[model samples]
Target: MRHSASFLPSRKTRIIIGTLVGLFFAIPFVATTEYTFRDVDGHSTIHWANVFDPAKQAAYRPIWTGLGNSLLLMVVTVAIVLFVLAPTMILVNLRFSKLRRIFEFFALLPISIPAVVLVVGLAPIYLVVGRSMGTGAWTLAFAYGILVMPYAFRPIQAAIDSINMSTLSEAARSLGASWPKTVLRVLAPNLRQGLLYASLISVAVVLGEFTIASLLNRQNLQTALLVVSRQDPYVSVIFSLLALLLCFLLLVVIGRAGNVGSHKKGRRK
Candidate 1:
């Protein structure tokens, strides 16, 4: 039998409540900030538009580079999280227990240390590895992977917990699927939402990261945000609005994906 209707609210009521809650915080954030925008005639301007001009872009080249780094960080972080951390975490938490407990402690240890302490300690280590590796991006990715690890592991474990692994694995084995094939084909499909959430966390962390990038003398989004703010406050506001918009878009995309996935599962059931 379905649950009682008394516990449930209509969709419109929920939307209105959510909208009000969001605007309550968002409005104040914008209001407290004194950043202004203008047109060529000193007229008022739009929010979240491409306010950058081509001729004046020379002043904003650093910003473009920062955006590139941020985007790259998102890509690299997602790749590492999916390929490296996801497998490592799943195998440990699922296949091994005592050993996984020890490793998982180490995995989450970074969260205990202060962000500043980690940044200072990691910079020199990355520099040394960066020199030996010949590709700074890889070393940086490894370091960023450390930051991403904590974000990726918990959700993956949660997703793993929610699934019936023994059934899936047994079914695959009966069908003569190889171990790797079973994991790749059967398990990963089940973990898609966890993967998406992990990727989102990794991307957001990598994009907004400043401490490691600045300490290592590598420019990233947060660093770029700082530089843009110094030269022109309004331009910095423009960049902030752009980042906010991108973040909003990403959440929307994720929600739509989740809805589609839910519908697909309903059809199968």
Candidate 2:
């Protein structure tokens, strides 16, 4: 009746797999570093120092603007996504549990729609939004919210699924807590990790997004990186590596936060 250990890879196999995965990522990073350092004289030297120099930033002003816009977009997108998804997910799970699958399917539709096609479909809406809002990063955030819904939905939904919605709501109602109070106090506190993950993933998506931003004539971080790359390849690469490093650090922080939250929740239980 016992299962065999064959499901798990042997130590030697795991080591080989780990090395291959490491090399798969390390090779590109090493090559990019070397390329960024190589000079016009074909010598691999430190050709680009102070990648984040203020003077360099002044020279590439659009990148700075684009970076600012992308940061704003990330904030707005995360806020909008959490605002809409959290409540909807909680309600669907509590009130209309049978329709959860349908809601999930619709939420995931964004991922299936090609960016070019989505842009084409949204041309009229974009035109109206541009004319009314005067075209800024805020406008781009609206589009980004739709694009990142699925990313937000998955985590928030997972968190909702883990909780006892019926029991919690009943207990809150019995205590004279209004529906809004119940959701805001009882549900929101339990779903903190989900909200955190949704925000993190949405921020990452918005920062790295290129296709829709480019097609919509929006200058975001990715677009800015492309613009800089055309003019100063070395600085662009260095900036890109720095951005990647920042994102990696953000992920590490979010992961640690999740672990801490989980540990605290376990202790409380």
Q: Estimate each model's TM-score.
A: 0.78, 0.87
* Predicted candidate 2 versus true structure: per-residue lDDT over 136-180, tens digit per residue: 777888888989998889878878877898899999999999999
| TM-score, cand. 1 vs. native | 0.78
**Which pairs clash (backbone N, Cα, C closer than 3 Å) in model 2?**
none
What's the residue-level lDDT of 239 in candidate 2? 71
lDDT of each: 0.76, 0.84
Alpha-carbon runs more than 4 Å astray in model 2? 1-3, 39-48, 254-269
* Overall local distance difference test of candidate 1: 0.76
Candidate maximizing lDDT: 2
Clashes counted in candidate 1 amount to 0
